[model samples]
Target: MHSRIGLFLSPVHETGQDPHLAVRRNLDLVEHADRLNFDEAWFGEHHTLGWGLVGAPETMIAAASQRTGQIKLAHGVVPLSGHHPFHVASRAVHLDHLSRGRYILGVGPGVPFDAKMFGLAPDVQRRRLDEALPTVLELVNGDSRITQKTDWYELQDAKLQLPRFNPHGIEVAMATSGTSSSSPRLVGKYGLSMTSFALPFALMTPGAPDHIGLAQQWKYAEESADEHGRTLRREDWRIALPVHVAETRAEAFADVREGYDRWLFEYFGKAAGREVISPDTPRERALEARVEAGGALVGSVEDVVQGIRRMQEATGGFGSLLVYVADWTSYEKTNRSLELLARYVSPQITGSAARPQEAVDWAVASRAAGR
Candidate 1:
């Protein structure tokens, strides 16, 4: 099956950038992706951080649906641990209606730091995820009255007053990063489409083959599926990672240099506590460390194509590639990076680039034959 090309906008704007524009640019990029024929764009929700400030992904998706023609829009994730399951279900179905079936619901156990501000214990999130998903899914699937009680939330015969836009039901994807997720069994129990984010240490170790446990993720899901007598389709499985491409490797690397340092210090360092390369390090050395991390696809368009191919094999194949939006480059250049992917990388991966090149080759061959 042909793979989808989508964007995952955690919407990582740096400290100095205007919050309004950061959010606006995310929509603009969605519009741009729509115009470019990209498959989908997923938005993140976060209230605590100065960066990634699009607090309500449903709102972003609703706004984006108006600007876009057909590109699929999704909540990159709604933090299940932090909100009532009914609220999640209602908003999800609402967005599904607003997008005319273009919306997908991706849910997770909430980011660790974001959970901190809500005063939710780290372990509570894991438990809440397992508890909340069933209720949320039940509500979204149809107006089935549910009665359930958990330490975090309670629902008594609750159902959606508003009917779901799609009778078939909304697509709910489970966002799992590394082993942080405690609900793979539940994931398979429900047969939710799996959306895997790049693990923080994915490429940190040399010779760390096996796609950062991509295959393992599916293995656990399939095992749990058998236990529940249901099959989770790999066609819905998605892997997301960082990407930035330009006309050349040098240009691509250069494009991300300025804001890259700040994003490291501010977002990754302060916010995430996962900064691999410090801004305090010597400039050249800091850059060298980044190049060594091997996490991002900061190279020519062709490089991205090849890198994704390797990832595809390592993951054993996936339905879509959602480019994790890290705005560590100029807005114009970031837009260009995506354009290059649409124009070059996509066709190359699908083997369509060769046909176009072959047509040109045929024209050149005739000229060489003195036609």
Candidate 2:
């Protein structure tokens, strides 16, 4: 099977831009991805940061499901720690039917800031997720009554009222940053897929790029899967990172420098309480560092191809590459970048296969139906 290329939209618009317009632009992006024949799109949920303003990714996914077809839709994640598993299962079933089995359930422990805002501590969120996830899985895939009582929530004799559209049941993925995270083991134990967030940062060790560190993470996942008598295939592994492909290296760097730097320092750095000033070093060297450690992709198509090959070599091989969404320049430029990736970068990695004609027909009819 060919490696898949996909998009992960945190939907981080320029701060203070009208929120309504930002959402419209995001919708436009998903539509464009569909037309470009991208494999999937993962929408994110965040409560606090303007950079990640979408609080209910399901609302967005439901809307996008109408406008496009063929691309799989994921929550990127739903913060299960704060939600009732019964409700999450119901919604997941409804969405699966609505999307005609195109939905992938991605669940994560709530973000620290969002969890605090909801009046829960970090450890509390972890505990909640542990209780909620299995309950959700049982509710979605099993017919038996599920009664569970936890300190934070309770589900008593809960069963999904709606039948799943996909007879095989929904696929699940957990987000994790590294091997040490309990998330890998937990997901592995359940035969769920794993999403490695921030591929560049995860590959880092002591201020340098370390592919060995990346392999070690995969090793942990493999071992965890084995211990639980579950199989985790390398092709089920997805690694996501920021990527922007322009006509030239200089052009790509210029397109992303300002917005990327602001995101690095203000959104991430401030959240972590550190100063991540852009280096006074030469532009090329600094840009290389950004790719190696910062997880930002800024270059031509050839550059992106080389980067993916390097990543594949590091991980031994994985299923998919998800491009992190960034409209640092403009929406038009962002759309153009996707076109470039689909046209040049993806074919280079996965081979040039024509977009299936049935997919094209399905998208056309779905767009015409407006649902």
Candidate 3:
């Protein structure tokens, strides 16, 4: 029942803001996470999306590595379809060394906007992801003189110039989405971990009897691993959710209402050609829709703890819960929320072993007091 707490930053900021400030703010948050003893922080990569301003997660990872210690730095996901495998392998290996073995190489197909930016169609992007992943794996695993050619890229005797700092080698994770995904199978085939994104919420809605459960994602990974004669560990699974905690539900709702609405209705709805809900919508009604969409986790600390518990049950279990970073009412409130999460939520979820004894003592004390 104990799950490690981490942060997942798409580095989503309002368009037109200074991109330099956005990165500085994100790095500050990463430093904060390290001080709070957060297990990891994943930085996202996007090219065309104005909201996701980080074009290269490795660069940010390298900078953040110098600012903090102990916490692991993840690529969040680098789109393999757009980059040369040799480049990806070399940069990942170099970053692993820079972080001193605290780096995770997460791969995924490029997003639609990024694909278009690179003059690739969706189908081509997926094919590139499938074909290029294994080659990157081989190069990072110390393969030399690799002579492989794909429709997208070619390698002739390609190999990493630097050895991995970790003896076990840099950890590799593939990003997957929806209830079922080919990414899980691919991750399993390579004996790598899986990071669930846009999942546990991809198509969720209120009172919808059936939605993609977190357990289903794990199931696909397990099945794929079984087929490949490899055993996938549940602890290797990481799930991301947008969570906001405060002193009260009302305060939490108020803190997130503006930013959440802008993200849901304005950015996503308009971008996807969906109808946008009115900004003047009632908070309660907005809350319902947000819950349905699996966007914000707005509540008090106890509520967030219970929400995570429900997710754990739904997933059967997972190794980590990564909080998705987005704009809040103010930067100060955002930092406070992270502080409360680490101070309050982390202990509750990770300290389950001592709960039984504490509960027994409380009951016994109540009986003795004749309450």
For each candidate, give its TM-score against the true structure.
0.89, 0.89, 0.90
- In candidate 3, list every pair of residues with a backbone clash: none
Superposition TM-score, candidate 3 onto the true structure: 0.90
Could you give candidate 1's per-residue lDDT for residues 304-340 as a string of tens digits?
Answer: 8877888788777887888888887877998899899
- Models sorted by TM-score, best on top: 3, 1, 2
RMSD (Cα, Å) for all candidates, in order, is: 3.2, 7.9, 3.6
- Screening candidate 1 with a backbone cut-off below 3 angstroms (N, C-alpha, C), the clashing residue pairs are none
Model 3 RMSD vs true structure: 3.6
What lDDT tens digits, residue by residue, belong to model 3 across residues 167-214? 888899988876656888887788898888642353225433122455
Two-way lDDT contest, 2 vs 3, winner: 3
Model 3's alpha-carbon lDDT is 0.80
Compared with the true structure, all predictions reach lDDT values of 0.79, 0.80, 0.80
